[model samples]
Target: MAITGTSSFSVNSSPVFRRDVTSASGNLKRNLDLKRFAVSSEQATTSSTTTKKFVENGRMWKKSGEESETARRVNVEESERNGKSLKDYFDEAKDLIRSDAAPPRWFSPLESGSHTRDSPLLLFLPGIDGVGLGLTTQHQRLGQIFEIWCLHIPVEDRTSFADLVKLVERTVRLENHRLPNRPIYLVGESLGACIALAVAAHVPDVDLVLILANPATSFSKSQLQPLIPILKLLPDQIPFSLPYILRLLEGDPLRMAADNLVKGLAPEPTFGKLSHDLLTMSSYLSVVADILPKETFLWKLELFRLASAYANSRLHAVKAETLILSSGRDQLLPSQEEGEKLRLALPKCQTRRFDDSGHFLFLEDGVDLVTVIKGAGFYRRGKYIDYVSDYMPPTPSEFKKIHESNRLIYLATGPVLLSTLEDGKIVRGLAGIPSEGPVLFVSYHMLLGLELYPLVTQFMIESNILLRGIAHPMAFKRLKDGKLPELSTFDTFRMMGAVPVSAANFYKLLSSKSHVLLYPGGMREVLHRKGEEYKLFWPEQSEFVRMAARFGAKIIPFGAVGEDDIAELVFDYNDQMKIPYFKSIIEEATNGVINVRTDASGEVANQQMHWPYFVPKVPGRFYYHFGKPIETEGRKHELRDREKSHELYLQVKSEVEKSLAYLKKKRERDPYRKMLPRLVYQATNGFTSEVPTFEP
Candidate 1:
């Protein structure tokens, strides 16, 4: 027999069945007794027919005057048993019943200190369960910051995808009227994400921002599609219940519930140590099983049809600024692929892939998801402005902070001597370099880009200019299907005016007359294999040279030698690949993602490198040398010639090599070249360590 509510257990007699029934029944009875007694003391509140039905079903009805005496007796008994008040048990019981509801549509408004008529409204759309109960953790936390509203669709209601869209549109309009000037943010999870997209497309001039987590766009193509055919064959009213069949179809309901609970409670490092809540597990499984049998055949068919329709829906109408949180570990759908598809279709879209999170990303990583939302400029207060076009350059205060932090690294790594070449002669410090105009510093990347901290900071300090470094796309992109890497460095990179290496961004920076740093070697240089240190792995194309000539930008080729001083390469990519487990991990991490080593050719092809494998040794001094500037001014015509551009590229590459050679030779003659002398020198001098340099 199908379990409807708490009353269904009264009909079951099997021993195994009795245990489950008794657990839920006992809890309900204890709670009702406590609640009935409380009601006896207080005046009876007005009750609806639905409340009366629930009371009758739970067997909690009582006549008028007897409640007070019964309540007093129950209160005394409850106090003796647990020394807790009747109200505490009543609340717990209420929560249990609330959670046990089949296809729950209940909404308990969260109290928020910042909630006001003017606060930005956030409407949350839930997954296929339609329960809208999983995001309790998110609601409690985010509600304090933004006005939160969760959509609850009753299981009995037959709402089409189009109907759902209309509902969302109407809700957003109502909220807009309440706030008037504030923007609305539609947050969707799985199926809800698809609904939000459809709503955004249908509603014009709504000015909504979408935050979608593990959207169910690939539901039609997923493994769940096969089950639809089987569901169709089943009779509308079968002789026996289909809960066991549904459980098998669902695949390990207990495990699924346990996984979600564990992830929600103790994420990442504390992953599996916590014990599973058997009560919660029972409730979750029972709710799903109960809802499946009750849902009409037509409703089940419509659900599948709606999902299929949404999978193939046109997304071009979605013009709102959208932030997609695609979980890499999502098993229910191909979230990463779907996110990319959506990103391509939408005009303004940013997709972040969470490598470690599953389909229930909001439940597992709510805090990080909220952090990403705030970072996307969706939660700004007071004024409403278009943040997409607003370039976030570092303020003077930020610059000072970065400068001071880098200063410590500079002092620790010995003195950072800045020099430039003039007429093929080495000139110490910034005196030889030009003071103005758009100048691009094309530098050879050291291992892990360790030279960046010293190079960028020293240039800014001495020349009073910030070097806007062009970074690898991976640096800005989230880790694919893995735990979040350190975000502080990425944030710092952005604040210090770092942009992904793109021709469009490069042109924009040059047009603004800013000092830009370019590393043509890219990931090839950073993830270089053993014996590839200080080697240039530049691509054959001379596109940057042609672009630089168009803007009359000065190309300053620079190089540094210091990675070898700080660490030694004990293992390389070949060594990593030899181990089967390690190889699988590397492949998983880089699946469908492009890296320099993925399809390397020429000098880079010979390296066959992966991520850098190094063992730290005693730290030694770092050396940097800048080559004479190659003026691209009035050389646009020369750069336009493919042969001339190739020649110019060769000249820049040669100059960078010269700087590397100069530093390598000069560093050998320096007194602080070895770590021992540098440490001794620092100890003797207390705060400062002087290094003797040789003339080049």
Candidate 2:
């Protein structure tokens, strides 16, 4: 269980870790070799047909052509379509059983899809296991974001910790020199995480982003005091049982395998295949003794002790932006506590807690490192975050997870979707809605923006349209001290295609022929007082009409009602202002963000942060109405007059009000508008079945 191999002890001054590697890399050079695969993205991603090889076990691991790579991917995909399950992971590691001897080297995993040329270089520092394939299942996905290099410290390789640091630092320095604009990523697990921190401490100036999973930097010898002796006393026959013991430390294999099936029930054949795979994978687990023998186990334990101390000392000098992934159920170390300490010690740090996950997070079933990175807003091609370009859309799996998580909201509030046709006939479903081009949907902000998820999620599900919401500027605001606002909470907005409200962003989105969702009422509408539900607090100006005309976009006025039915705003901004403590915190948070409404006039211009508390009512149905699309296509030139454009703006506003009026009146006629009837209907049908609303 000792995660000790990759941890390096380094002082403030970067320790020199150079050694003559000519003998070790001779076999690599003699075979077909060119630039040791790719050090970073630009160099690594070349013509698709060309072979990319890296040295593994004194052999050139090569993929000759596209056909072979495609076939390999097909087989891999068929075996584990969702992701590499626990069984597949064990099967992949079976090769380590032979106990072959070799030196530490880099391996570039094969990635089928095309990736950007400017992708960052991601070097994975191994845990105590030393077999760098810990990211085995994640390689294909990570390959799209990074030109991956796995540091494999051979089982019997006697390389010192300092020397290993030197070797990695050497590669880092060389890559940074070649692609000065690109940032390098260091992904480490446990002992590997400590090594990554050591590198960051030594090379503080390099543009490095560290993703550490259960770093052992906060280790205490007392924690391992009980297990050390028992590990050393293992007799020769014990190696056969090593896999059983290690699997206990690793995680529950059956539970891990079952995680892959969480989406739904599988066919009998699938379960039968899973059972067969489990038996096959068990034989691979027996290779654990070969990978980490009793002698090695005892050595790693002592090494882990030293690794912990040195890594602790080096934390002060680390300047890289760090993301610590801590597991709540980690049996090996107090990773959750270590993550907190690291967050406080490091200059810029963020921690993500996987409460249900094990110590080996990357190997776990539910964990997707790439999705985690996106959600954290840590994935970047260069130095600064270009909120628009660097934005990664939700993967199919991510979208599914998001939808299923919010299934309750769907069940509680049976949404009534109605759209206007060309003839002005309102109909159910979005059949009347246009699918083409630069479309702008002007909307009202439901209570605390409760209508957002249903609106956006439905658009994505029903029409395959991603409504890039024009989010309030506060969501993208930075702190006064110059540190970025916390990533964990706000970055999800970015991941879901929410751009900070700006004229420039609007223009860009329109120019790209995208569907832009805008809420003119902004903060004032969402945070309005108790009785102000469904009221438009929009500023009186031609803000977006002219811009929509410039792009000849279709402006659709949409309204959502039923916030009052779902929750009652028991406490609002007026109520909070009566209390000094809540009032001051609200003012401070609001003042920290840049002032956007300084020159604007009216009640809507009083833009401020308001944390309104709500008390849930019996769930009621939500009703949505999309009015007839107003075309600005050929009117671009005619609407140039200030009076003409302003007039058009008022027309759009009236339509939004009309839609609101339509939904409010119609929702009352629905039979299952209240919670009791809806629940009864769902009980008869299915929890996820769409409950009927009022006839359009």
Predicted candidate 1 versus true structure: per-residue lDDT over 265-341, tens digit per residue: 44533333222323333345544444444354336445645754764575877888788888766666788898888
Per-residue CA lDDT of model 2 for 1-696, tens digit only, reads: 111112111100111111112234522222223333323243234445555432111111345554322111112222124355555445444443234455676655433223445778888998777777678778667765577777767667767676677777777787787788899999998888888888888887799999999997866733565777786776856663355435433455456446647856574654675466556546655556666776776666566677778789888899998999998767667888888888878877888888767667887656888878887778778797655556556755677888887888877777778999999999988887778768899989987788888887887787767778888766654444222245466655666778878788888778767778899988889889988988888887878988999989999999999999988988888888889987887787777677667889898787767678899998888888999999999999988888999998899899999899988898878998898998998899997677887788
Off by over 4 Å in 1: 1-389, 396-412, 421-425, 478-489, 592-609, 679-692
* Candidate 2 pairs with clashing backbones: none
Alpha-carbon deviation at 104 in model 1, angstroms: 26
